[model samples]
Target: MLVRLALAALSLHAVTAAPAPQGATTWYAVSTTPQGDTVSPPTHWYAVDTSSTTTPSSRTTSSSTVASSTSSSASSSSSSAPASSTAIVSSKKGVGYNDEYLTRELAISWAYNWKSRRGGELSEGVTYEPMLWGRNATGWATDAQLGLDEGASALLHLNEPDIWSQSAMNVTEGIDSWLTNMSPFYGKTNLVSAAVSNSPEAANLRWLQYFFGNCTQCEQETHAVALHWYSDSFNTSAFKTWFTDAYELLQKPIWITEFGVQRFTSSSNVTQKQEFLEDVIPWMEAQPFIERYAAFGTFPGRFVNDDGSLTALGRTYSETV
Candidate 1:
């Protein structure tokens, strides 16, 4: 497809370096363009000799525009840490994409937080969050252990349970699972609710009713809400209406883990994505209840290109940051 070719071109911006030996530690300083997209020939570079046996961990540090980071744990964690702090892992400006393909150094090299599926290494100054998929108790246990070991600040619960293709849990089952597996981590780390699918069927009011009615333990144990938003209509009102309704019901801080104007069905919608970001970014940044948010991805027609170069959408999204 033409889109794939464009993304292939986008990845060409990455710096060429000798691959690290298997299990060897390597460091890279991911530089950003004036537009805030990742590019080659890092502005500054440093590498420390690391042991092959070092158990990876996730921490984030920042200096002006640069985020100093170390990596461990794959995508989907939460945090209340300040975004500008160079010594903490925060969820403030995050991303959800393929860590193996795009990489922290390639796609979201400048970002503060990011996630994929399983745990992996990241560039300096970026925090990685681990996600629990479906009702898989095994996966949850694994991520929970990783969180405890790495001292993660927060934990993202199930993926979109409202969608069949994702977690697909009924209300009773969702609450029960949360109490059994996720509640124990309540005081240990912030527990972000399972992200609901982006539709009225996953209505905030309805879902909350089911959850609050059944799970009394999770009511007080949980810390924040995670959300996913995508709109066919690219406008301020569309974005505002959905979030406003959800905010009214939840009355808790919100973290928009995945968001975009529309799915990447065509390249012609670049302007639409840009317009949407221009309106939404400032609004979300100003809202007191919004804890953190990450755009849908870094692919073509999304925020940035596969190689982390800024697209028009990326430019608009990074304007305030």
Candidate 2:
């Protein structure tokens, strides 16, 4: 098997079902807790199995039909095409694990076949985009050099340049660095802008706009917008607005490199956190302009556990993909 999906071995306590009224057979659905504990939820076997089988077959048929339709549509001129003919295409879901050494393993735990940084593949379907953090690293290759050496599908630049604890490059320094180092990779590979914090000034949306407005060369070179959002707000409206606006303003495909409901208060509700994941994930997946999204925190409440078992959020993410 290629191991394209995250498979976790949870500690399950199976309870024998009650003798099903003599002649009846039943099936049960397994549910996991946020702590990675597994439990069997009551399920009607026939309904569950029938629905599962039918859904996949129907989706396969639909996918085939859509592929054919898209091919036929591509042959027509853009001006002649119908406005409502375009369908929403989903981008791949990825993991944003902070550990460089556990890149492949964390990717597996989260069912992420795509990574943000380059590394050895843990399985057959893995792919990645190389990153250039900052000027402090030793023996770091420039973006252009890395692109030539690795042949990446895309290249990521700067971690969080607006935050002092991360890349810490001021606006002037960021522009200067981009012009000198990052600009060389312009035509060689898909150039992604430096990911900025949600902070004010040029670090977030403002910083991205500033970069494009000031640096003609940088603007011309940019191919995608990289964004990061961490918030306690569980609602999707706020995120949707920010995301859609970024795309409309920048006129570039957006990559939500990092996004999650971070615990901002001591009263942060677990239910609300899970709600955020359930709602926001599907919303992002439906956006055609969103090229990719990486969920922050693969360990504990974020998704996976220390022993490699998947948390509730992790399971939701895996199933969503």
Candidate 3:
């Protein structure tokens, strides 16, 4: 239903965008290219993490607001409560992994890869949230349908659309693609949105605000919002600022589908990554609004050893509460 939009009706006072600062704009996050990229990876995406300012742009409000989005037809689906199930016991922690079987080791709570199918024979009760990567990801619609038919509880929308490399899509294209491919599944499952990048320029929030403004039906259907975060080193203050800005604008429960240190580089030490994890995981769990989160697993850093064992960082993330 339009729960996302409904939850978003709560408005902030007369506010405006804050001036961009230096420290926040210095970092960039290059999305890790999927192995199946038939050709060379595109150029890196350097997001300017502007100061955490929930500046009210031209109707770029919360993920859930805007009165004139969709038509009456949308209410047909919106009328129905999303399919519910006891299969997924709620937990704030999950593993982001490419290989599902390896998750059996860290089997903390949940796991998801880039695709729709729950990888093979996943641990029982380990909820597998399927992601429809993007419009560029061929057969995304069909795959999303398959996941819904298979009783996937929560279906993720576009990846990092704010980033040119990952799930690159403008607000209009994102809405059109979603309405055509993902809208039909609206009330059938928990639909996550935009999966906006941690663009330092505050592009992620803007992208979402525009999306919610333009596509009322799409915005109405989105059950939760998704955010991706990355930083060169473990800077918890930067982390908090980014997440806070998003929540203040969106006002919806969040699913941090991807996050990590050394987002696009290998310079991150295991200890630093562990410090990052130890610092963020508890903070994430403590936040009542952060429904669930999954780190960028397997690549860019070592979540599992080549022998299929948890690395120190992995163990820290897996074993921590």
Candidate 4:
């Protein structure tokens, strides 16, 4: 049976699902964290599942109802039509873990034994969303190694591409080089989005433009761009206005990679989180260019970790998306 399964694995199967009722649309939330990790909060992803069995039918004409008088020998023939396609909507969820530990485990489990473990099968039918924090040599190496091993897909979070004090143009060049070198092994990589904010160097329009201009390589590589928006820096209207304007300027599909209301002195209360989501998500979704959306940090704390988990925020994300 195993041998037979292996033999049949490469064959592509046609998949279809019922058309969304009237104006309804379906979006999938693919989780980005590892299968079983407790510390890191789960990252919810929205991906279009291109593989399914439910097919939509076309309208058919009724044969002449009054064909009783003639020979009365009628036959019906069926025609096969092309399948309909659906769009994938995905978001990022962050689970905390020492980066090295997660990457090492992933390499061992997914890459070496992928073929036997049905990686090809999984790849064919479902869109896997993996999140990568683009920082440091070790993290980048780990991400590349894991991709080679598991045959996994990713939405790389390149928030601060240059931890060192490199210019935005130089940083983009470096990223382009790194991705180019890694491509042979990784195949077609999908960069969900990238950002460069909260840095002293990246504080001006010239820097932002340079950073985005560098992202031209990413677009050429078919990677989508994610722009980060922070509430602390800008008010709701201002934030939306800036992003909308930027999207127009960039002329590429953008995802709100990270947006949240942070309470530094006290823990994040449910009210603040709820208000933030209620105000932001709908307005952002209304835009046509924004492809996907993700909230920053699943728990209440910062990226480095702190006390208290905003369970309410987590629940709200799951419920709303």
Candidate 5:
């Protein structure tokens, strides 16, 4: 009965459905008001499931196959991998949270926020990469550019543009904004393409295909494919399927910026998410194409509680090798 994926209270069984409806614009975002104020939207289910917990599944992988990386893309020797100093750590493990304390407690290697600024007391040792979350990444360049000089090797580009609720941009709009806001970093750093949702719907995953097809030079600017996955399924194989598809489609390094279970039922529990993490985290770490990753746990419900105590799911994720 040990469970883990994201929601521990629920069954550890792998989920088969996307947590949210396809094309749903209900995901979270960092938006800007007309008055130039940065806005934090409601976290809702997307932050981390507040209703349940998951176990680290004792580190068993249930997937039939991870996306088979091509002979060339899977292990092709590239420039020596970036040193540990890069904003996205070479360890390829991280947590999505604003609290420096949680990151320190978990001892994860890197961190990221929706915007480009490195938030509060995050240690200098924990490489912090910046993201241009939405279309209006106002003033993101000046701050993120500094990473170049600081040896930050990666820049997370637009958020989920396919989902109207996230970045909400069409292919043309997304590329235009990327060229304007992200192109400058093309050679200086690894530009992670827009992170799209893991939903099987055509729009969610196809967005990247459309983007790369249209922008002939975009592949040069993009060092890796930024990806995300959210579901209620307990099947670890499903996670692998998603990863395989993305890898085969893009044939580039993959950075799993966000991936977790969204507990929508009373059965959700930490063991489920724990199992999910145990299966996926280790798999991701071993994969050569999976350059980096961070579980989605911005609020207390995920890695820790409101009192700042590590939850069952958190314990597994932190202790995971």
Candidate 6:
């Protein structure tokens, strides 16, 4: 069952954005403050975007800092702790597939290369679920084949359920059966998570419910609700509202799987991105039910400029998260 984003334009050109430089870095980690208060400054640490930067020198480092006051701004509230259980972190350390570079052929190629590179098997505890678009039979087969090789789990993306009418129930059922048959070898059955169309499109929620409700297997097997909440269109309050609503309605754990602010194109500067992340992290960390939050495009090549540098938002994400 290939899950896809119904609203994302699916042209050959649109799907495969140019790959970033081989040595670019995308993700970096930072230490949390001891008191679990706000992020302390002198937060200048940065890493190359791994998706783009392939240079040998572009490995993780603890260098870099920005000067700021250390005085404690104490608050009475207790800080939240990180989520205890999550899908096993992949033993293969690096970025997974790039959404912008997704295609049926490319996805197949990636599965082959990824499986081979990771010792021709999935990491013992890690799950590998790539996003699939459309009713792509070949792609689904490829995913099952890769699962056989890697022993990884998967999550199918149902981009648009409204298009999958009752008339197509037979086809959907067949796909469901195929997925179930593949599950024993793959370690776990793949779950389905729908993409929410832009906020103005109120019908997307109905479409999501309809699709999930119709698939008995998916309803029973699905573990998490995934969403891509872009910081650009949503302010802090709006995101909080959405998170709260999703928690109340879904009952399943929520993963803000893909999220980021576009600092390169917007009038909002990098400081805004940093501030936004700084503000959001504590709030998200505090949420008891929320699972992991992965920022969009941690690779420098995906979002940064040609000079091999960090975008303001990228820097902030690295520093704060």
Best by TM-score: 5
TM-score of each: 0.65, 0.62, 0.70, 0.48, 0.72, 0.50
Best by lDDT: 5
Candidate 1, residues 236-308, lDDT tens digits: the string is 7877667655655565567788776544425677776666776786676555556667775645445556565
Model 3 lDDT tens row, 172-198? 678788887778777788888868767
Model 2 CA deviation exceeding 4 Å by range: 1-91, 100-121, 142-151, 200-202, 264-268
**CA error at residue 219 for candidate 6, angstroms:** 0.6
Q: Is 1 or 2 the stronger prediction by lDDT?
A: 1
- Candidate 3 colliding pairs: 5-64, 17-55, 48-200, 48-201, 49-200, 50-200, 69-216
Clashes of each: 13, 1, 7, 14, 50, 28
RMSD per candidate (Å) reads 18.1, 20.4, 11.6, 21.2, 10.8, 19.3
Model 4 has an lDDT value of: 0.36
Per-residue lDDT of candidate 4, residues 180-263 (tens digit) = 543433445554444543322233222334444444444455344555554343257776766655554554556555555534
Task: Give candidate 5 regions above 4 Å deviation.
Answer: 1-90, 99-102, 264-268
lDDT of every model, 2 decimals: 0.52, 0.51, 0.60, 0.36, 0.62, 0.38
User: What ranking emerges by lDDT with the best candidate at the front?
Assistant: 5, 3, 1, 2, 6, 4
The residue-by-residue lDDT of candidate 6 on 234-312, one tens digit each, is: 3778877766665555555555554555332343465666677678866765565455455544233333334434455
Question: Residue 5 in model 5: shift from native, Å?
Answer: 18
Model 5, range 207-253, lDDT digits (tens) per residue? Answer: 67767766767766888888888776678888887786677667677
Distance from true location, Cα of 200 in model 4, Å: 8.3
Ranking by TM-score: 5, 3, 1, 2, 6, 4
Better of 4 and 5 by TM-score: 5
Distance (Å) between predicted and true CA of 166, model 5?
A: 1.2
